[model samples]
Target: MASVARSLRKVFVGGLPWTVGTNELRQYFSEFGHVVNAFVIFDRNTGLSRGYGFVTFGNPAGFNSALNQQKHILEGNVLQIQPAN
Candidate 1:
């Protein structure tokens, strides 16, 4: 099984308003880590957020900084930051 720290990089964001896009989410988390990649979950047909997403960082230490500082959020919604699996 993968550890929590690895998972933390791939956070599960929630409660994102309909207006927000994957780019916006990425920009938000980038402050914490060197955002390597970010993908906001979306419906296959509609391409909309299922109110969650994943943010991966280049370095694990950056991920830890984001976690410890509690710097995850988007438009006032506190993110559900956690491991990917």
Candidate 2:
């Protein structure tokens, strides 16, 4: 079997609502494309949101789509989305 090489499509999301969860993040981003994975960074000690997260897309197209958008509003808060290093 041949191995398929896929380009990683990950984006850094910031300014998330304090109450935002992984499921909500994935649901919101899913509008752009297939969401491979979604996670919200948390404060290990407090187990609370760090106001940031990551969203991975199944393909580069989805990543670009979300990136090109002006801004995303989640729960009345504007989200900061950028290409993840």
TM-score leader:
2
Model 2 weakest 10-residue run by lDDT: 1-10
Which lDDT value does model 1 have at 18? 69
Runs with alpha carbons beyond 4 Å of true place in candidate 2 = 1-7
lDDT of each: 0.73, 0.89
Best by lDDT: 2
TM-score of each: 0.76, 0.89
Candidate 1 deviant stretches above 4 angstroms: 1-8
Q: What would the TM-score be for candidate 1 when compared with the true structure?
A: 0.76
Backbone clash tally for model 2?
A: 0
